[model samples]
Target: MLKLESLVFDNGFARLPEAYYSRVCPTPVPDPYLVCYSPQAAVLIDLDPAEMARPELVETLAGNRLLPGMDALAALYAGHQFGHYVPQLGDGRAILLGEVKNAAGEGWEVQLKGAGRTPYSRGGDGRAVLRSSIREFLCSEAMHALGIPTTRALAIVGSDHPVYREDVETAALVTRLAPSFVRFGSFEVFYYRNQIEPIRQLADYVIARYYPELAARAEPYAELLREVARRTAELMAQWQAVGFSHGVMNTDNMSILGLTLDYGPFGFLDAFDPGFVCNHSDSGGRYAFDQQPDVAAWNVTKLAQALVPLLSVETASAAIGDYPQQFGRAYIERMAAKFGLPPGGETVPLLMDTLQLLAQNRVDYTIFLRRLCDFDSTPGALNAPLRDLFPDRPAFDAWAARYAAALRQQDSADATRREAMRALNPKYILRNHLAEAAIRRAADHRDYSEIHRLHALLSRPYDEQPECEAYAAEPPDWAKRIEVSCSS
Candidate 1:
């Protein structure tokens, strides 16, 4: 077994001023129980399985005990939620347990979400419900399996306690690891407070830790902002291509390393609805499915504004101006992969036109895209998984004709195209209906078999798992619009 010292402790960020974080320990919970464990995450952190799965270690993970050298602290940051500035929204429900290096020598932040309250609790119990914990755990693993950059979940620990939201629910904690938990909001806090020195130090630390290559540049802060913008745009593009709706694109939820974090009220589009809003608390559909790119652009502009003090006006403007074009290029490349076509200038408009048709016709997002993998010149041979998507065959025929014509010019063989399309198009997504089913099974019956099954299938989402075909189907009538709350 690899000992703890085998993993390095290069604590660069902790060397900064103490005001950036609050030195506090997790307020332990009672009678912690293991809910789930990630063998893959253990391998990444190189933790011994026997040690990690032990009851004592599980209790430590649940915030009921402290681990050796673990400096659990609540990080400080501010964020703009739904365009409303919340100047004091820090880690009200999370604690950064500590930092550790993996076998690959990469530093990762180990955080405990719902590990009890801290100084930043804001008068609320800093505990997480089992329902939300399950969703986050499954989705983090599912998103990673889909090849999207995201924070990985280490384990989940459940307790015999209850928390009140809409009703009483069992509480749990999730241990998640990431390269850095710093956010756009972290910089915003300093800029809002007019604390430029701390902002400068924060920028320098970010540049050194995440974008080390930029630290040597003449304008490292400007360069750092641009790197984050470019990476964030690409991440948003990837999300759109997969029909993902983050539900909450707040600045704090935005990772400095461009990872998907804070999975709350998130959903995958079953049907192609551009205006789909998964978050029930969002009275206004500000962060809809199609509006993610715009939200990302807006957030990057906010980041750019925060760094303006460190940059010349012209440099800031230039970096800001590149967002649209950069997002266009990145989004198109992902679309090309989805359609099994080589990426180029012409492919963009064609894909956009097809998307317009899909949105107009209200087609099933996953099924429509998945079927396109088998699209050929023989029009009538195409199979429709859901006939309601197109009222008649002629509508699909027209689009299929155009698509087939484009495919014919490709240099790649049909088999290769089909294989590539299958690889890019996921066979499974965390549809709200499916996620609800899994959560219900666990919460009501204490049966985690469905959760385990769904996890296994989602891990290989692009493959044809013949036995799991039912899991990929559309939601039932009742689940079509099940409301999801911010609390869970």
Candidate 2:
């Protein structure tokens, strides 16, 4: 029940040296208005949902004005871009407004993406368009609903002011909330500069604030890298299980805290293609759907390299050496849960077979997995619904028989297993087609109803909401033409 005016503000990152960030104010926009607001995220910082109705709320979020507690600034960091080291790349469009502690005393940093120019703007306008802004806002909530760690979106503010990308688009700002906005690049920038003391200070700040348990360890810096590797591995497993493609896995985009930091050119599987490259700008397909795990491991290795000054080469390398094992175990365990089976090396073959079959036939990833929940293990129990998804029904039948036999080995009951599997495998994801539909409605006609509808639907993605059944359907043919770039 907190009001905007009543909320106390603090900037933890701002307490760092001046070189860590650039002081900046949000450049104002024209005729700012509220597009969508998330009450679930709002309550995280105890912001009253009622306060969203105030004109000042949109004004504050859109950089048209500021609340008494607000102190905006853009952070500084450098990162690897497409495996090449970029010496400087900070928050080009994102401005951290301030940080606030929720009722449970969990700190949440409030940031405005597309709030205009900063030192790291790199000669480009620090503006986010309506299309990309809406995608980030919805996917942030969608990922969170799926029990995945991600930065939360509080609200989106739109304006009549035009921003040019491939086409002319209206400007928008998404208010992002996170425990901390620090990334792997936050340390990489200093490490590459050979600034060892600043890197140590940054490491100390992170350990003291976020990973306090590691501070007591004999080798805290190495322990921190190990902990980050573990988290990144687990997160990659979740992303893979759910068929999500984070088209950009730059070190800067990888959260130091292991949350899904940046949402750009991201997609959920339509037809199962392991090499699905959602980012149109990524012609090289480096961050493909199936490549996420390896990419994450690479990013973590880059993080270890950044911390090389604090820890020995062998020490830093050893800390993250177990990343592959960690990722493998986590992914297999999740796949087992989706199949209502126990986690073991034995289950991996069945899991791999399921993926292979799905890919070979180009089956709709979400639908096939959800339908598998009802697969009857009993001999001669017709799995027509499951088999119907594949163009190659014979291939599916072979896979289904193996899966059924595997289920029998686990001694699972059909009804009990179906219920459990449904919980793990979502019926609805923030599909690119769905998001595009909502964005078109909002951008073209200024109709915000679809955005509200999508938000409500995605909030309970695991539920069988019969009224929203159309949303669970496969993508239409035209959806193939929908392209999302790095800018998105």
Candidate 3:
């Protein structure tokens, strides 16, 4: 079991030169308490799940106490936000508590969000409010449950201390776990500064730690670029297939390892609008639902530019060249599995038509997809309830006929297909309203049961969870009024 008192941290990132980060101790919050935590995440570092309830875990997470071997500091990096390049933007409010190995001997970095002021704070109050913290904490775990790669939330510590956002709200800190928090922005900051050595050093460090297999390659740096592009394409495809809009696809938010790194202003597709902008602050809809793949390619290109000093321009360009095909292939394969159809030309059009059908009808993406698992190849009265979901019966009939034909061609059995599709198309997603509901009870009444309830429900997203079916229902009218931004 991982012990809070004696857990040894061997921080690889900290071993890099002082130029990569700012050594800063986390500023403590007042009267902190555990909001909720993930037992699954606690197990990632091989800690006993019961340990999450202990006071020391909450204290350490709340920045109230520093544990042994914890080399606390904030990362320094810059990125392009909404397509505009910012020369220097770093961890303004987060402090890395250093890294430790799990039972499998994998190093995981522990980080605290809303841990207070750093050199990168830039005159703003470096504290995260409970509102956004709940969203991040829940969604991080929720994404992982859906079989998507994302950073894990270990715990959330709520504080009575007030923090200002749109309103005066209480402070909260999230303990996020990841293999590495290194982003495309990490290399960008050095490149923009016209410093070659730091860029090379950062690249070398990343290669050694995460991409060690590339060490002996003739052009390891170029290979790193290709691998990043490939992984990023796959990540974007996963996001798209699941109807997830990251809201902000900033280079800094884009993980170098292709994990869903940051969780700000994110939303899942409620009504299948391709132009859905989850981040209200994004005036131009730059990171829209349908545009995620294209934006990801754009971000990968930025990472390629950052690596120009380490490899030839020709090699770097070639590395990112396959992004479109990579994303297309991965997306179709995932969508095919969600439809329980093997990916091929025949299934490709069915998937495209499904998207068109969903977009045209403005259907509840999750519900419609989940219900499709029980699709009958021989449609009859059995499909009436499914048919009721579409506004236009004719449109639904046309698509249903094609889908049925595809299933018949594959000789897919209803029982087997239903099981496969149900596993891929989750019954539960972190809908904005559901997250809002959890945040409300936790913030307004100081009752965190909803937070605990949500973490449990989302952890088994693919399961039926018949008792919690209300969570998988269509969003309410009040959900439309909810607007999240770059704030928090």
Indicate which candidate wins on TM-score.
2
- Model 3 TM-score (2 dp): 0.98
Model 3 local distance difference test score: 0.90
For model 3, residues 1-488, the per-residue Cα lDDT tens digits are 76666577777888999999999999988789988888899888888878877887888889989887888989999999989999888999999998989879899999999999999999978899999999999999999998899999999898989887778999999999999999999999988999999999989998999999999999999999999999999999999988899998999999989999889999999998989999999899899888999999999999999999998899999999999999999998998889888888688877887888888998989999898988888854348767888898899988888889888888989998899888899999999999999888988798889888999999999999999989999999999999999994
Clash totals for all models, in order?
Answer: 0, 0, 0
Lowest lDDT block of 10, candidate 2:
63-72
Rank the models by TM-score, top first.
Answer: 2, 3, 1
lDDT of 1 by residue, 21-86 (tens): 887788788888787767777677777756665777787788877666677788889989999888
* lDDT tens digits by residue: candidate 2, 1-488: 89988888888988899889999999999999999999999999999999987998889999888777767899999999899999999999999999989879899999999999999999989999999999999999999999999999999999989898888889999999999999999999999899999999999999999999999999999999999999999999999999999999999999999999989999999999999999999999999998999999999999999999999999999999999999999999998999898888578888887788888899899998899888899977779888888888778777778778888888889999999999999999998999999999998899999999999999999999999999999999999999999989
What is candidate 2's CA lDDT for residue 457?
A: 98
Better of 1 and 3 by TM-score: 3
Q: Candidate 1: give the clashing pairs.
A: none
Error of 1 at 186 (Å): 0.5
Q: Against the hidden reference, what TM-scores do the models get?
A: 0.96, 0.99, 0.98
Clash pairs for candidate 3? none
Model 2: CA > 4 A from native: none
lDDT of each model, Cα atoms only? 0.82, 0.93, 0.90
